[model samples]
Target chain A: MRRVIKNLISALVALMFVNAAHAAGELHIFNWGDYTNPDLIAKFEQMYDVKVTITDYDSNETALSKVRPGGHGFDIAVPTSSHIPIWIEEGLLMQTNPNEMPNFVHVAEQWRNPDWEPGRNYSVPWTWGSTGISVNTAMYGGEINTSELFFSPPDELHGRINIVPEMNDVMNMAIMYEGGQPCTTDKEVLMRVRDTVMAAKENWKSIDYGTKEKLVSGDVAVSMNWNGYSKRAREENPDIAFGYPKQGYPLWMDNVAVLADAKNVENAKLFQNFLMDPENAAMISAFAQYANGIAGSEAYMPADLASAPEIAIPAELQSAGVFVPPCPPEAQQLYTAIWTEVQK
Target chain B: MAETENTSSVLAAQSHQVAIEASRRNKIRNFRLLSMPALIVLTIGAAGPLLIMLVYSFLKAAPYGGVVWEPSIDGWFGVFLKKDIFDGTISIATAHLSILWRSVNLSIQSTLLALILGFPTAYFIATRSVQTRNLWLFLITIPFWTNLLIRTFAIMQVIRDQGIINNFLIGWGLIESPIEMLYTDFAIMLGMTYVYLPLMVLPLYASIEKLDFRLVEAAYDLYATRLRVLWRIIIPLVRPGIVAGSILVFVPSLGAYVTPRVLGGGKHLMLGNLIELQFGQGRNWPLGAALSIFLLCVVMGALLIYVRVAQRGTTEHV
Candidate 1:
């Protein structure tokens, strides 16, 4: 009986080793749901002679939770730019050698050394866009160029508008609409924003994600949405239009990083290099309906996308565009409190 | 010969007693063995996370996301008090309290609405023949086949400004303009009623089907009007079903997230959404856990009172 038990244990250990060996040739990725272009993933798989397994998360919080304790064996993950610092502080990401990634030079200058990852050792920019308003031109019969149209609409537009459910975007828009700084930590200013949001709540159709479908279907005449989603919606319904709020919009970036416990770090680096190639980046941009951060990718972009106002940030809005930074703990709590009040 | 016979009989009786004791012990052991798997699963799956949440509720929320090991009651205090971000001073706030109150109020409203809408359908189904009753019940359950999100989305399609309802109303010249129907309190209540109506109907059907029709007939014959017969006889007979259905609908609606979130459009905050927000975007797990515990206690207390009242009712009836 003892001999049989010892043999069983040995056999199980051998099977585990075999399983590990089989997985070595595969790269696992966790990314934002519907954020990646599957064709690019297939192309990468073909070029690398390795299988690529991808998982998607809808929210940065969900992705962070999954990756916090060593990334659940994912080789690479796409987290919002704001979360890179937290990921590093939690030891969830692996440091990358710049020398291994020659394509790093293709990234735009501003995106190279993001404030979150100071030396740019961990993450590379994936896609970037701004949070702004998407309007059905036929319904609104004009351009929506300001947050005022959403927060304090005319009587006709009341109950015909929705805002994104993300706290940062909503609160920032409120702050900008009130002519205050987007990242203001002052209580008085925040309280004012809170009041504005609460007052506007009565006029809102809903505070929800995925406003693209609602806009296309004309369920809502106006919505606060990402530029990419607005662009995607426009393809289905040509009446849909996206505008940069004159009051400024929250600019956001999604970054790709290797996990600390990545089993296929080499493959992950290779994939990142492949994604950074201008043509590949343009392909991703075209597919995702979001602009990539690759500097020379515009030459490869399709004609319609290259000149599309929604995909390209106008020069005037550039100075007004602010990156959403992670707030301090107390400020975060305050934001949540105000958000809860608005929802209530 | 008599003494020998007595000794053999006594020995046989003692042997029989030993046999019974051994079998009883074996049966108990078998029962325990059979229950082991379930006990293990319950401990690991259900009780484990609950214990972790309880522990985390007392800990301080880490600045970034998760909780720190430091013990604190700040989460519990913060539920009803607003903490000043700058000075760290706290004051009584009605925001959270109002949210809780709103949740309770909406849940009660939805529960009553569901009950009103479900009773007639359940009764109609119960009065049907056995073959047809099953067909009706199956029809009632057809909604369950679709995902709740999809069903809610479909409901949105029918109720939106450019939706079928508005189009039909406009085409018929009944209304010149589209009435704002989606994302209102009415829409939330309607959605809740639509989702939980089946929960109410199933139990009511079960109870009404088992009811003795003779008592109802007797009450009717004794000069009891139809309304009086329903109020006194049918209602009393189905009291258990009413209580069961109310509990089933009310408790879930109290903590409902999706219906209110999707239909109410995040304007109508409920306890479940608050809890979810804490763990999701709010990044305040301690507060979320504390709120969860508070909600659980309230539910358990209400259930306890309900059980006691039910027991009293049963005893009085007996």
Candidate 2:
């Protein structure tokens, strides 16, 4: 027994020495739940000999609030495009200047100088998708390319529809449907936004996440959903289809950046540069079923993702997809009040 | 010689008094040292977060999410009032009021229903033989072995549109369409009642097990009906248990977040969800903090009322 204990302690010390020799460092990533591609992380870990830890946040606000106070110990964070400016303005994110990175040239020209990150200094695209209407054609065979299907649903659609409970996404669509812009501070538009959603809530059965499961389970015939989730749902139930709201829809993109107070700044920089590579970017898209901004990454993506209507935007509806920026404090307050009333 | 002897005796007496005082002080010091960790845990670990919440409720909300150090009453005002965006008319926050009403209403309903369902089960178990009573109690706690969230999901599986109850009813040709249970008020109430039923049972069992059957039999011998005996004798004896069980069920039900989210289908906001909304997507930390403090006050108020009523009941019974 004594010999066994002695051998065990010796073996543990030897293992620690081996680990000390090979290990480079550790990288902590805070991203959306189930959004990180495991394969990409595994590959990065093998190449760099660094351990990576991933944490999840359900919404941009959650991530922001958690990271804003500092001492979070997260090396990297993924913030949506709308929230990127807030993170930057708050000095929560480091200006890593990914535009100067070696693989940055592969970033698509359209995404190269996004409004959120001019010159792409601080962040790189993680995933980009649109929020639009999804419907099971077998339930309602009407034109689904309009927000009217939700805001003023027909008799057949009433009590059979689900609404995604995201405040910004829902409010942006409602405001746009009432002929307002994203983050508009016009009082009249804001009031209409309130009334529109309140009336629509009467028709909506639930406001929730887990759209794909609800859509596949025949729980809701129609829902306002993310395009990637709608695509996944369509695969399960062929009757289900994605509809780009011609009235207005949100084009959302999540971007990855290093924290200003990151302990492992070098490792974080390496991870960010790694994400810009075509193969790595493609892996991210393939896992999350979303699009990446790397131009050559599509060639590496699955053929189905490349050809699907959900992935590719038609020319006519292209003008309708609008990017919602983070609202100012006053407008956000107004929107929150309206949303709370609607839910109540 | 007498003077010397008196001095020695005096010194001995003073020293002995000093030793007694020193020993007493040592004992108190040891007690403080031994209990230092618990005191720190209670004050800092438990009350520290609550103190932070109380402070945050008075601060200004940052542009995005965090709080600013500047103190303001706007957060408290936002809890009960809303200003119109265009008209500038200040009105009662009907939305907050209604959500508050729904939470209380559902909690009351669940408590009442649990009492109705649990009293008999507890009585049946309490009356069983000692071995069987132990077995019954073990079975009563079986649901607790699983997670609260899992138990809620289990209830959802039983009542969903395509779930067991609906399918069973339809298969028997008793219904043409599945009765819409999920996402309705009924679904939330059912979830709360079922999830908290065990809490109700355990307390009632603890009280009923100690109940003497002689009084009940004596009441019956005097020509009292079964209902009268139960009401006049059994209920009074177990008043503390009922109060305890109701508090255990009602408090958690009022703050219920998961059951409503899972079974209630997230159609509406409960008090808990509304507070979460202000913190999360609403991006109003002060408001969320204010709401949470408000909820804590409401629960404290309810507990105080229960304590008073229970005290009154005990006094009246005596």
Highest lDDT model number: 2
lDDT of 2: 0.91
The residue pairs that clash in candidate 2, if any, are none
Best by DockQ: 2
Score residue A276 of candidate 2 by CA lDDT: 91
> What CAPRI-style quality would you assign to candidate 2?
medium
Off by over 4 Å in 1: A1-24, A141-143, B1-32, B84-89, B310-318
The whole-model C-alpha lDDT of candidate 1 against the native structure comes to 0.84
* Colliding residue pairs in candidate 1: none
For model 2, state the Cα shift of residue A320 in Å: 0.6
Candidate 1 positional error at B33, Å? 4.0
| Least well predicted 10-residue stretch by lDDT in candidate 1 chain B | B84-93
Candidate 2, superposed: residue stretches over 4 Å from native = A1-22, B1-37
User: lDDT tens digits, residues A244-344, model 2?
Assistant: 98889999899999999999999999999999999999999999999999989988998899778888988899999998888899888988888888878
lDDT of 1 by residue, A1-344 (tens): 99999999999999998666555478999998887788888788777777788888888888887777553879998887777778888888888754358998898887777776776788877888888989999988765778888778888898888887898778877888888876577877886787778888888888887688888878889999888899989999999988898887888888888888899999988888887889889888888888888899999888888678787777877777778787677667878888887777
What docking grade does candidate 1 earn?
medium
